[model samples]
Target chain A: MSDNSNNNAYWAANMRIIKIFLVIWFICSFGFGILLRPLLSGIAVGGTDLGFWFAQQGSILVFLVLIFAYASRMNKLDREHGVDE
Target chain B: MDQFTLNLLIVGATFALYIGIAIWARAGTTSEFYAAGRGVNPVMNGMATGADWMSAASFISMAGIIAFGGYDTSAYLMGWTGGYVLLAMLLAPYLRKFGKYTVPEFIGDRFYSGSARMVAVICLIVASVTYVIGQMTGVGVAFSRFLEVSNATGLYIGAGIVFLYAVLGGMKGITYTQVAQYVVLIIAYTIPAVFISLQLTGNPIPALGLFSEHTASGQPLLTTLEGLLSDLGFATYTEQHDTTLNMFLFTVSLMIGTAGLPHVIVRFFTVPTVKDARSSAGWALVFIALLYLTAPAVGAMARLNLITTFYPNGTTEAPLSLEEIQNNEALDWVRNWEKTGLLKFDDKNGDGNIAYVANGEANELTVNRDIIVLANPEIAQLPGWVIALVAAGGLAAALSTAAGLLMAIASAVSHDLIKGQLNPNISEKGELLAARIAMGVAIAVATYLGLNPPGFAAQTVALAFGLAAASIFPALMMGIFSKRINNKGAVAGMVAGLIVTIVYIFLHKGWFFIPGTNSFTDADPLLLSIKSTSFGAVGALVNFIVAYLVSNATDDVPADVQELVESIRIPRGAGSAVDH
Candidate 1:
C-alpha cells in the first residue's frame, strides 16, 4: 500500500513537470512567436523584431532546450523514484 | 567534365553510397526488420529521425513558400519543430516504455478493442500513403530537372531505387542509410546557403545572416527587403498579412500532427531504452533545425538575389526585357525552368521588363516557389557541382521520408492488421514475409498514385496532419495520461474527429479535389476565416471533448488496464520490447 502511495506521488510529480514544460512550450512558440508578436515589434532583434526572431529562429532554439531539459529532469526523476532502468 | 556529367557523377555517387549502406545493414529477423532489434544509439536514431521527418514539402516547397509568403510562413517553421517538444515530453518516452513493435499494437492493448486498433491502422495508412505520394512527386521533379529525363522516367527510377533499399533492408537498413542521408542532405542544403548568405550579408551562418546587414546594399536585410518590395508595389516584408487566428491554429495543427505521425513515433521505438527515446528527440530536433534554421535565409536571400539579377544595379533600374531574358547567357537557368512550364515571364504591358507584385493586376513574373530552392545555386551563379548536390539532396529528402512512411504502412498491415488481428496464429517467418510483401505493394501503389495523383496530394498532406492530430494524438495521450477513457469513447472520438476534419477539408478543398466539387473556396471559407488546412486544431479539440464526454457515460476502464497505464508512465523494467 505504501509502495502504491509512493508511486502515485512520483507520477503526480512527473505530470506537474510535464504541465510546466508544456506551458513554456506554448509561450515560446504560440504566445511570444505569434499572438503577442505585435507587442514585441518595437524591440529589435537583429534586423527584425523580437517576435519575428522568436518565430523563425528563437522558437526552434527554445524547443531544443525544452526537450533536453525535460530529458535530463526525467532521468533524475526516474532515479529519485527508483524507476531507473 | 561537362556540367551534365558532373551533375550525374555527384548524384550517382550519393545513390551508390545509399545502396551500399543498405546492403551492409540487412535485417535478419522480424525484430531486426520491424524495430531494428532495438539496439540503435540515441544520437544515431536522432539523425535518422531528422532525415525521416523532413519530408518532400520541407525540402522542395518550404523555401519557395517562405519566399513568397514571408512573415506569414512562420507557422511552418515553428509548428514543425515545436511538435518535437510535445513528442519528447508527452508521447515518445511513454510509448517507448510500452515497448511495442507498432503504434497500433499499443492502441490495441490500451483500448482492449480490435476495432479501435483497426481505426488507428486506417488513419495511419491514409496519412502515410498521402505523404508518400507527395515525396514521389518531389523525387520526379528533382530527377527531371537535374538528370535531364522526363518526370515519368525519373519517377520510375526513383521508385525502383526506393524499392531496392526499403524492401531489402527494412528498418535496420533504412536507419543507417537515413544517417548517411542526413549528412548528404545537410551539407547539400547548407553549402549553398553559406555561399548565398556570405554573398548577401558578410555572415556565413545563414540564420544570423538573415537579419544581418546586407553587404551589397549597406542596409539591414529585412529593411532592404521591405524597401525593395514596396518599391515593386508589394507588401512590407515584416508585417503580418494573414489573420492571427489562422496562423495560431495552423501552428497548433502542425505541432500536434508532427507528434501524432506514426512513422516518426516508430523511430523512437527503434532506440534501446525509454531514456534514449527522450534524448533522441532532442538530437533529432537539432539536426532538423539545422536545415529549418537555414531555410528562411535561403528563401529571403534567394528572393533578393533574384530581384538584383533582373536589375543588376537595384530596383530603380529597368527590369530585364523579354529579349534580354531570352538571349542573355546569364538567364539560361530561367530558360531551362521555363521549358518545364513551371516558370513564366509575361511582359504583361509589353514594356519588355518584368513586374512582380504581391497582389493586384500588372504582374508578369510567375515563378513556382518549389523551383526557387532548386534554382538558388544557378541564380547565385554557383558552380555546377553545387547544382548537382542539390539534386542529390532533394532526392535524399524525398526518398528517406518515402521509405519511412512506406515502412509504417507495411508494419500496420503486417503487424497490426494481419498478425494482431486476422492471423494471430501466423508464424514469425510468415509475418516477416508479409511485411516485405506489404512494403512492395505500398511502393507500387504510391508510384501509381504519383503517376496519376488526385491533384490534392499536397493539400491532403495537411489533412494528414489534421487526421493524426484529431485522432491518434488524443487517443495516445489519453491512453497513458488518463485511464478513464474507455474503448468506446476512443472510437467515438476518433470517428468524430475524422468525419469533421474530412468533411471540412472536402467542403473547402473540393471532394477529392475535383475542381467543381468544392462547396466553398478557401478565400470564402464557410467557417469564418478558418482554412481547411487550419481545421486540424478544431478537430483535435473535438476529439478530446467527445472523448471525455463519452467516456464519462461509459463504464470505467478495467483494473489491469489501469495498471498497464501506470507501468508505461513510470518507465521501468524496459528491456527489449515485447508482445502482449
Candidate 2:
C-alpha cells in the first residue's frame, strides 16, 4: 500500500476498535451502572445486585482493562505501520 | 505517647522528608521546572499522577460524602475514575505526541493564535484556583482535627510549605514527593479500611467486605444496611435518590472535567513518549482505583458500625443514654470529632438518652459527613499510630495536589503568557526567575482565595470539574478531531462555554460564590431542571455547536496546523519535547 492509504487504513482500524470500546465504557458506567440499574436489581451479587456492583466496583475494573487494552493494541498497530518510536 | 504528640511527630517527619526531596531534586532548568526533564518512569508517573489527582476531598471527605449520600454518591467514584478512559484513549497520547511544555502551549499552537491560548489560561486558572481552595480547606480541617489548632492557622502553614517546595524544585521535586505521598496516603487510607472490613464482615479486603454478610445480623451487608437506614427514616443503602437525568448528566460532567483539568493534563507532559503516556494513565488509574474501590466500603461499613453502636441490640432496642455516649469507648470518635463542633448531640425531649434517628423533630445527633474518614480509625478502634498516619495522609493529599496546581498556575504565567506570547527572546535564567516569581504569586492568590473562600468550598471540586468540562475540554477535543475549526471558532467556543457554565453556577451559587449573591438555590435551579454541577455537559454541547456553526462561516485552519494535527495523531515518531 502507498503511504497515504496505509496511514488511512491504520487510523480507520483504530477508530473502529475505539468505537467498540466506547460502547463497553458506556454500558458499564452509564448504562448498567445508572440507567438500567433497576433492571438488574433482582440479580444479586455478594449483597447488592449486579448493577450496584457495576456502578461501584465493576465499571472501574472494566475501565482499567479498557485502557491497557487500548494501549497494547495501539502499540501493536504502530509497529505494523512502521511508526514505532 | 499521647495521640497529639504522635500526630505532630508523624506530620512533622513527612514535611521534613518532602522538603529534603525538594532540595535534592531542585530544578535548575526550565525543562526540569516544567516537565521534570521528561524522564519519569511509567509506574512512578502513575503513582505521582495518582497522588496529584486525589486531593483532600478524595482522601478526607469522599467517604464522608458517600457514607451520607449512600449509593447515589457512586457518581463521584464512577465520575472520577471513568474519565481516565477518555484521557488515555483520546487526549494523553496525542498531547504527548504534540510534545509541549504546557496545555495552553498546545492550544496556542493548534489555533495559531495567542488569544486562544489566553482564553485557555483563564479557564485553567478559574477551575484550578477554585479547586485549590477545596484542598486548602481540607488541609485546614486535617490540621485542626489532629493538631488542635485553628483552621486558618493550618491553612497558612500548609501554604507556606507548598510555596517552599514548589518554588524551589518545581515539577522535579513534586514528582518524587508525590510518589512518596502516594505510598503514605494509600497505606494510611487502606489500613483503617482493612481493619474495619475485617471487624464487620470477616473479609480483609474492604471492597469484598462490602459484599460479605454482616456478622452481627448474619445477612448480606447491604441488605442489613438498608434495613437499618429505613428504621432511621433515611434513604436505603442501595436505592437511587437523585433523579436519573441529573445523576447521568452529573456523572458525564465530572468524567469529562476530570479528563480536562489542566493540572492533571500537564502530568502527561512529564512522561517519556506517547506510549508511556498511555500506559501511565492505566497505572495511575490502578493506583487511584485502590482508593476509589475502598472508599464505598469505608462509607457503608463505617455507617453500619456507627448505627450499630447507637442501637446495640437492634433498631428496636433503646438508644444509648447520653451518659453512655459520653463514656463508651466506641463513642470516643464522636467526642473527639465533637471538639471540631462538627458532631453535635442534644436531648430535645428531656429523655436524657441520645435519641438518634433521621426524624427532623427528635434527631439529637448531628454529625457532618466530612468526619467519617478522619474518624474512621477511631471508629474501628485502630491504634493511635494509624490515626496519626491518617493525619499525615490527609496532609500528603492536600499538599501534593496544591503543589501540582501551583505548578500549573506558574507555568501558565511564565511559559505561555510571558515567554511564548510576550518575550520570545527571554533567557533560560530569566524564565526560571519568572517561574519562581510566578509560583510565589500563584500561592499568594490561592491562599488568599482559600482564606476568603467562595460558597462552593464543599462542592468546589464539582465547580472546577464543571468549568473544565464546559470550556477547555471541548476546545482541545475539537482542535484534534476537526481540521475545519480555526482560531475564531476555538476562541468563541471557549469563551461561550466558560461564561455559560459560570453564569449557571453563579445563579445557583451566589455571584462570585458569595452566599447571598446567588439568585437561586440548588433546591430550585433554573433551566432544564438541571443542578449547577450537571450544567457542564450542556455547556459542552453548546461549545461544540458554536464551534462548528462558527467554523462553517470562518476560514479553515492553515495548512501547517492541519499537518500538526495529523502528526499528533500518528504517534509513531514521538520524541522528547524540546523548547523551540
Candidate 3:
C-alpha cells in the first residue's frame, strides 16, 4: 500500500463489499420483514408466515452472519492490498 | 433458605464479585483508566460490550413489550442488533485506526476545530446523561423489588457500588467486571427460558421452542399463542398491526442510534488493534443474541401462561374464581406481586371469577408491564433460586450499562474538556484524578435524577437514541468518509440535527419532557404517522443534506485533514488508542 492508487483501490474494494452486504441487510430486515412481507405470506414457519419469522427472528440471525462475514472479507482484503498491519 | 435471604445472598455475592474485580483490576495510568490500556483480548472485550449494551431495558422490559406488542415490536429486536452491523462495517475499524480514547477527541481532531469537539461533547453528555438516569432508576427498581428496601435506599446502595468500582478501576475494572456480568446475566436469563420452553413445548432450547409444537395444544407455539390471544379479544400474536412507514423509521432510528451511542462506541477503543475492533463487534453481537433470541420465546410463553392462568381450561372456559386463586399454591406469585402493588384483580361485574379482557369496564386484572420478567420464574413455577437469579441478572444489566455510560461521561469531561482545553498542561496523574472525580460527580447526579426523575424517565430512551442518531452518527461518518466536509459544515450539521430532533421530540413529549407542555400527543403526532421516536432517521437525513450543501458553499477541508481522513481508511500502521 505504498502508493495513493493502492490505498484508493483497497478502499473501493472495501466499499463494494460493504454495499453488497448492506443490500442483503436491507432485503432481509426492511424488505422481507416489512415492505415485501405480504408477498411471502403463503410460506409458513411455525404458526406464522415467513415474513413474521423474519421480522422477529430471521432478521437478527442474518445481521449476525453479515457482520462476521464482513469482518473476514475485510481482513482478507487488507492482506490482498498489502494494507495488513 | 427463605426467598428473601436467597435473594440477598445471590445479590450480595454478585456485588462482592464486582467489587473484588474492581480492586484487582484498578488502573494506575490514564491509558488503563480510559481505554483499559488497549490490551484487552477481542473476545473478552466482546463479552464486556454485551453487558455494556444490554441494559435494564433489555433484561427486564423488552420481553414484556414483545409479549404484548407482538409483531410490531420486532422493530426493537432487529434495530438494536442490526446496528452492530453498521458499527463494525462503517465506524469501528476506522475509529480504532484513528486510535483515540473518546468520541469527541476523534471529532475534534478530524474536523480540526475546538468548536466541533465542544459540540460532540455536548451531544455525548446529553445523550449519555439521559441514558444513565434510566439505568439508575432500573437499579433502584430491581433492588427494591428483590431486596425489600425502599427505592431511595436501593438507589443509594446502587450508586455506592458503582462509585467504588468506577472511581477506583475506571475502564480496566469495568471491562473485566462487565465480562463477569455478561456471564451472570446470560445464565440468569436463559435458565428459566429453557425450563419454560420445555414445560410448554417439549424443547430444551427456548429459541427453537418458539417455532416448535405447543405440547398442550399439539400446535406450533406461536400459532397457539396467536389463537389464544385473538380468542380473548387481543391482537393476534404473530401479525403486524402497526403502520409500515412508522415501523420502518422507528427501526432505522434505533439502528443508527445504537451505532452512534458514545458509551457503546467507546468500548471498541479498548481492543488492541483495528482488526480486533472489527471482529470484536461481531463477537459482541453474538453474546447479545444469546439473550435476544431467547427473549421472544420468553415473551410469547409468558403471555400465554398469564392468559391460561386466568382461563385454565381455555379462554372460552370460565375464569378462575377468587377462592381458587387464594388457595392455589401455584398462584402464590400473584399474591407476592400484589403486595408490591404490581398485580391487582377486581370483580368489575360483581362475579365470583376474575375477568381479563380487552374491554376497559369489565376487565378485572391490571398488571404493570415491568413486573413480567421479574415475575416470570414464579409464573412458570421454576422454584426459588431461579427467581433470585433474575434479580441478580437485572442488577448486572443495569450496573454494567450504568458504569459504561458513566465512563463515557467522565472521559468526556476529563479527557476532552479539562485536558484538551481547560488545562492542557495538566499532568497525567492530575488528569486521572480529575477523571475519577468526574465519575463520582456523574454517579451522584445520576442518583439524584433517579430519585427525582423527570416525568419522561421512561421516554428518555427515545430521546437518547434520537439525539445520537440525528447528531453524532452522521458527523462521525462524514468526518471519516468525506474530505470535503469542513469544520463549519460539521458544526452546522450537528446543531441542525440536534435542534430538529429535540424540538420534534418536545412537540410530542412536552418541552424538555414536562408532562403538560406538549402541543401534540404521540397518538396523533404532528407529522403523519411519524412518532417522535421515529424522527431520528429524518433528522439524520436533514443533517446530511445540510452538511453537503454547507460544505460546498464554504471553504474546502485543509490538506492536512484530507491526509488524516485517508490514513484512517486503511488499517496498516495502526497502534493502541491514544489520549492526546
* Residue B171 lDDT, candidate 3, scale 0-100: 39
Record all residue pairs in model 1 with backbone atoms less than 3 Å apart, i.e. clashing. Answer: none
Q: What is the DockQ of candidate 3?
A: 0.83
Query: Which residue pairs of candidate 3 clash?
Result: none
| Per-residue accuracy of model 2 over B186-278 as CA lDDT, tens digit each | 999999999999888999999999999988789998989988989988878787888888889889999999989998887786678888888
Fraction of native Cα-Cα interface contacts (under 8 Å, chains A and B) also present in model 2: 0.78
Q: After superposition, how far is residue B234 of candidate 2 from its true place, in Å?
A: 0.7
Q: Which scores better on lDDT, 1 or 3?
A: 3
Error of 2 at B437 (Å): 5.3
Which ranges in model 3 have alpha carbons more than 4 Å from their true place? B26-37, B149-174, B425-459
Model 3: how far residue A74 lies from native, Å? 1.4
In candidate 2, which residue ranges exceed 4 Å CA deviation? B24-37, B168-174, B423-458
Q: Residues B426-533, candidate 3: write the lDDT tens digits.
A: 898898888788778778777786775442233456557878999999999999889999999999999899889889988987776566788988789998999888
Taking all chains together, each candidate's TM-score versus the true structure is 0.95, 0.95, 0.94
Which candidate tops DockQ? Answer: 1
